[model samples]
Target: MTSNIGSPAETTQPVGISPYLSKRIFTLQFTSTPRGARLARRLVAVRLDEWGVPYGTEAHETTVLVAAELAANAVRHGHVPGRDFHLSLRVTAELARIEVSDTRAERVPPRPGRLPEPELAEGGRGLLLVERLAERWGWCPRLGAPGKTVWAECALT
Candidate 1:
């Protein structure tokens, strides 16, 4: 519930938050750089471990990869000088949601299953990975803000 996503040290939950609900959500903002993307992936993995999902498990592995791809795309295609990208992970009894938001709202990724035919020689396969790993994925313009958010969901049950 707290909007403190600017750095790793600022992960305090809001006042009076319930412990059960607090563990279900995690959010952070990072510089729109490769290091930031890497941090996004690492942090999410650590959080999953704390939540009992643990690394190396199917749920943890898929969610981490999905977070990495989204974060990398945010840095590579959605970077805007001085603007940072945001990451949010939410888990429930039956599902997990990963969301990455960046300042470049105009640079949304290709829709699911709409990647260019035959693939490219040098790159352009990140979303394809998300499509294969996530139960579903999509993007939307940041509500009441500048930029967009790309989100992927996975079933835990």
Candidate 2:
């Protein structure tokens, strides 16, 4: 029921917020640099732990791998020099939704196709991995912004 998205910790916010106004959307944003991408992945692992999904568990492993690939794609393909990528891990007891948004508005995502063999090429298959692991995966134009967000959901049981 708390977040530190692009600001100070929620508990530090005035200390008398209406319960209805307190948000639970925890977002962690980082630069679109490779290091930031890497941090996104690591933070997911740590955040998952904080959320009671321990590292090395089946679900945590799956989610972190998904985060790594998607974050990597954001850095490699979605970067604009002055813009940063955004990562959000929203949980609601039943599911964990992971989103990575980047600031290259001109680029649209490709629909799924036959996956290239990782052995046969130097690239491709990132989304294929997502599709195979995540319960569902898709993308959307960034609402109120010039970028797009690629999102995937992993069920929590």
Candidate 3:
């Protein structure tokens, strides 16, 4: 039932009790590798475009960048041998969320708003960028899974 990156299959589901407020969801699993991370980013862009955000809009660009950062982190830090990372994109009338889940439970990302000092290192600032670009970002244990899900939310206007 999994869809390919070139043509991501979207499932529309109601987000709340109000029937007027519906959300579109796209979910896919990719290998925990650099190539898979890149594919995740590209697929996110495509899915957003299909969802009416288009390709060059600010909302589209911001969401795509956030997805790229999360995917990269999943590949670099949360990767587990032979386990694939999961990407989920959910878009509503006012918000778009990007979630990247990996199979490494012990390597949860730092809490949001308490970002590490930028002067401490030359690298490892992906989450910092995510925080700056995303309206809000955070991580939590994945339900029914063995790892964590790092999510970034962008306001759609």
Candidate 4:
């Protein structure tokens, strides 16, 4: 099967690709639409369940919140006509990382800022929630393309 760029080369790369690298990375791409965002959140819950994170448990709760916010931003702020967003959950020995990438290269996600009043705002609270939940969170411009990926990580218990 043909593969996209930056995907590991089928033939070979080199030695010393982390001996303890993770094997349970789950990734999927969905259309850049509101429905897609909703699906992303549902999928995260399902996957976390598969990995034994019980519903309403701390890991499950934290991961779901992070996934939901990132996917919503991908749909709301980073969507481009005819493009899709990618959602990835990578769990290593020490952390769980959730990433959402979408095709709106010109727009960059702002750094998390102060929270607004709960009754006075209809928006601008997503990043605040992310900052409070994640151990660390940030974004990176997709190389060789016109999109950005927002990612968050939390410790593994």
Estimate, for each residue in 19-40, the C-alpha lDDT of model 4 and write its tens digit: 2453356778887888988888
Model 1 residue pairs with clashes: none
Off by over 4 Å in 1: 1-23, 118-122
Stretches of candidate 3 off by over 4 Å are 1-20
Candidate achieving the largest TM-score: 3
Order of the predicted models by TM-score, top scorer first:
3, 1, 2, 4
Off by over 4 Å in 4: 1-21, 112-122
Kindly give the stretch of ten consecutive residues in candidate 1 with the minimal lDDT sum: 1-10
**lDDT of the candidates, in the order given:** 0.83, 0.77, 0.86, 0.77
- Per-residue error (Å), model 4, residue 38: 1.0
lDDT agreement of model 1 with the native: 0.83
TM-score of 4: 0.78
Q: Which stretches of candidate 2 lie over 4 Å from their true place?
A: 1-24, 112-122
Candidate 4 weakest lDDT stretch, 10 residues: 1-10
Tens digits of per-residue lDDT, candidate 2, 5-69, equal: 65456312236765334433458778888899888898888877776778878888998999898
TM-score, cand. 3: 0.87
Worst-scoring 10-residue span by lDDT in model 3: 1-10
- Shift in Å, residue 91, candidate 4: 1.0
Q: Backbone clashes per model, in order?
A: 0, 0, 0, 0
Q: Over the stretch 1-157, how does candidate 3's per-residue lDDT look in tens digits?
A: 1353324223644345442377788888998899999999998898788768899999999999999999999999999998999999888878999989998999887799777788974578899899999999999999998999999999988
Shift of residue 20 alpha carbon in model 4, Å: 8.2
Of the candidates shown, which would achieve the greatest lDDT relative to the real structure?
3
